[model samples]
Target: MKSPGIVIVGAGQSAAVAAHALREHGYRGHIAMLGREWHKPYERPPLSKAVLVAAQEPLLDVLAEEAWARSNIELLNGSDVAALDLAQQEVRLANGQTIEYEKCLVATGGEARTLLCCPPYRRRVHYIRTLDDARRLRAALQRRPQVAILGGGFLGLEIAHAALAVGASVTVLERATSLLDRFLPPEVSAWLQSNLCRAGARVLLGTSVSDAFPVETGRMLLATDAGARLEVDEVVVAIGLSPNDALARNAGLEIGPGGGVLVDANCRTSNEHVFACGDCASQQRPGQSQPTRLESWQNANEQARTAAAAMLGASPPKPPVPWFWTDQGAHNIQMLGLPADDLEYVRRGDPTNAKALWIGHRRLVPIHAVAINAGSELRALRPLFDRDQPVQLQDFHLDTLNLRAWAKQQALADAAVPR
Candidate 1:
């Protein structure tokens, strides 16, 4: 019989990071990772970008074979976990096999939200969620067909950009007034829309596909809510993501408000032996009222470290400010902190040239920031957002102000204060 140690369900970014963190935390025991995917753990960000445009297969593997072998971590790929037997502290697989574990981390992640109006039809419709999904879409895009993206969110814009790069006619349909309206400042959203339009792709705002049907031999017809018809070769859906928490819920783990395994500060689920992280875990942070499932690469990595520490009974690291980024068409937009609608926006540089940083402040306290092709400057600004004290606008009022020096000074000042 194999010795039981830490068993992580779902081999994605969160699972891979948790396994590596365990070894980093000086854990030398039996570690098994079961995943439904055929390939080893890979990153998801490339699925919408490089995977679609490149002819060569992108290196998306998070952990190499040698790393797993060196750590003696058993990876059970293509194994579908049917249920979590909480009573027995075992993971029951679909093939009638059970793996007992001292502790289990559920990082099942999420699935792409599909549209009811445009279901998959003979490969005419595609959704970029898994590796297989990206491969299929990549092959389809190679034909240089007209591509219609269903959403104007990060993924949709990214797919549109990729399609355009491959000589495919692209059109992005968004139901909102602007791209990423809820998250970005109005001016920034406008700039994103303008950039996409300049890249030889059509961006339709306040429009939604009401119906989709086959039009030609290898094409699809999409009807818009605004009474317009668009004939396209492929339809890509990027609406949102739905958490895969059925295993946790069926096993009697308390789920959060928006359909994720409810976890506390330490990423512990309702059952003490089981924990959840990544997109599958919903958490109510220190100041938030409602638990939110953050679907970002940074969140997944940080939460995985936290879950790993908690499993070892070690002190978990403090959560940092929420950050997300997207790359599309000569622009790299990075956002820091949570979204708030009432904050005032102050710009430090010109956004038209794609070198600017916008700070959202409330009562002279920086809450959020958006960096347009200024990632390094954005990193320097983190000290302000991480700090609890209010900052004077004069510190960064000048466009030529050295934010790096300002950040270093603030760090020194913070360290000088007695805890």
Candidate 2:
């Protein structure tokens, strides 16, 4: 019997992983990937960090050109999927090309939400979602220009760090009272703010831009709502993201409240043959029925793997513990497992030194440690976050709770038989 042809839309991490996994599972069908960007599928995490520092490193391409060709996956770059005909199981591209597929994966990721308070920058402003955006932003930074970031979220802070690294003066304008208000608590956010300021970047909280207009010498005059004015060379917007669910909605597929395509645990959409993953799909948790969407790289990669397996009628692999990490200035913060708002928080280490663990539900749920070069330490504590056997706060000896010892204890405990 002939295998089924698989078409994956969106050439980000998720779509690329799905295409590779389908071929790896011995599927001898035609595999095609559609990407709107001119470049091949690549990782987004490095765009804000390493790529900002070095543009010629090819940070965006997640898969090598030679490897993709060897896998027999036809990559259609700079092609947009205009419409989806669910009834016919076909996708129409902007170039007037139609591809029939036995299975389709929609991984069209979200776009950065620009600030609406001021008029458009007209080629003067930039957003760092695509490789092109990063290239332009990097060029601006190379000029040793002054940068005014519009938001205090992760993206904004990451960009701020990169600009400062190149000796560029940065001023971050945040409407919120603190940075990273959505993810970190007040204390944690405050700690992050202090670190950014210490790194020579000025952070303005509870302030928003009233108007931004081009001025002399490639500079912009920003009128603040707080009766202040800022003159900067360029502006970078990192407010948030809005999902690209228009394609699914146009096809009459069910969408969630926050503009995400609704999908089941198996990553299947309302139409069984069409699947969605990454930042585009809104999926329910393992036990909870409430719809949720995660924009982290971990979620995107894991969901892609699951969607590919399900399409091939293979047993899905167990989902890894959801985790995310951020690199800002000289600190490396890693968050393992989920931290709920209602859950009680207990600080296990010193915040000033950038080494601490947050305990939730009286258990070692999320560990966020920061240091100059603590990548190894952060990776070590990841496996200790076992949902099945929750580690209580008392089980952690703050002084001696290194990564290796913690992992050994958790392994022994998990290995023991239960009554």
Candidate 3:
């Protein structure tokens, strides 16, 4: 019998990883990757950081042409999957084409959410969601312009960091009382706000843009709800994202309350043959009744691998601990495990020193150690999340042989040995 063919939608990291994993597992069937963007599957995390700083050449391409060709995966770039004919087991493309497949993976990611307070004001604002958006924003920053960011979330802060690095003045206006208010606690937000301000970016809290209009050359007039009018060169909106679940909804697939395609632990949608992952799919965690939809790169890659394994008739892969990292100015911030609002937080190191550990449910769930460059410390905390026992907090102190260092050393040694 011939191997079943698979069709993967959306040419981002998740879709690419899924296709790669399927082939690696000895799936000899035909594989096709459909992407809306003209470019092949590429990495996005660096678009805001390295790509912005690198010279003319684009740094977002995750898989080179040679690699894709060698993998024997067909790439359909600059094409959209309009509809899924579940009954016929086929996918309809935007260019009036259809492909038959035994199974399909929907990795369509979300689009940036723009504030709709006023239609006219929306035209003057820009959003950072794709490589093209980053390129445009990077060009604007090169002129050493004054930029206004809409939301004080991670995206806004990261953009601000990039802008500052390129010598552009920035003012971040957040409607919430604190930056990252939804994810990080109040204290952490305060620390982040201080760092942003110290880096020369103005941080505005509890403020909303009332109106925005283009003025003189490289200038814009912005009216705020706080009865303040400000002038800036450019405006970048980083409010949030809305999942791309319209196709799923049109196909009569189950969707979450927030419009995300609902999927089971195996990454299978309501229709068993149709699967979903990445930002668009809402899959519940082990013990949580509510579904979780993460917009991080880690979640996308891991979920794709899981979907690939399940599609190949392999047992479900173990879920990796959810980890997220953000680069702001010179500080490298990382969080491991899901932090709860009710959990007690203890500072292992001085926040002024930019190093600390967070204890949750009597377990050291989050290790936040930041310095001029602390990528090593961030990598050290990844395995601690998977440990069966709670990591002692006292070991985090630099002076004493700390628990974090000892635990990390042991982990490194264990990883070095062959299984």
Best by lDDT: 1
Better of 2 and 3 by TM-score: 2
lDDT of 3 by residue, 1-419 (tens): 12259998898989988888887788888998889988778888777676666567454555567656666888888879999888988888888898888999999999989766433234346787788777777888888888898889888888888888889899999998878766665567788999899999999899999887767664678899988988888888888899988888899999976678999888999998989999999988753458878889889988998899888789768988777788876777776666555555544456677765544433443322222234455456667556544454554555565555676765445343222
Q: Per-candidate TM vs. native?
A: 0.95, 0.90, 0.88
Candidate 1 backbone collisions, by pair: none
What tens digits encode model 1's per-residue C-alpha lDDT throughout 296-378? 99999999999999999999999899899999776898988887878888888887887888888777567889999999888
Per-residue alpha-carbon lDDT of model 2 for 1-419, expressed as tens digits?
12248888899999988887787788888888889998778899988888887646544566677767766888888889999889988899998888888999999999988766543456568888888888788888898888999999888999999999988999999999888766765667888899899999999999988888888776788889988999888888888888998999999999976779999878999999999999999988743347778889999989998999999899878876667788887777766556565555555567788776554432333433322234465466666554445454554536766656775566456434332
Which regions of candidate 1 are displaced past 4 Å?
1-3, 395-397, 410-419
What ordering of candidates by TM-score runs from best to worst?
Answer: 1, 2, 3
Which TM-score value belongs to model 3?
A: 0.88
Off by over 4 Å in 3: 1-4, 56-58, 64-66, 117-124, 216-218, 362-375, 378-384, 387-398, 405-419
CA lDDT of each prediction against the hidden true structure:
0.88, 0.79, 0.77
Candidate 2 minimal-lDDT segment of 10 residues: 364-373
**Cα lDDT over the full model 2:** 0.79
Give me the overall lDDT of model 1.
Answer: 0.88
The order by descending lDDT is: 1, 2, 3
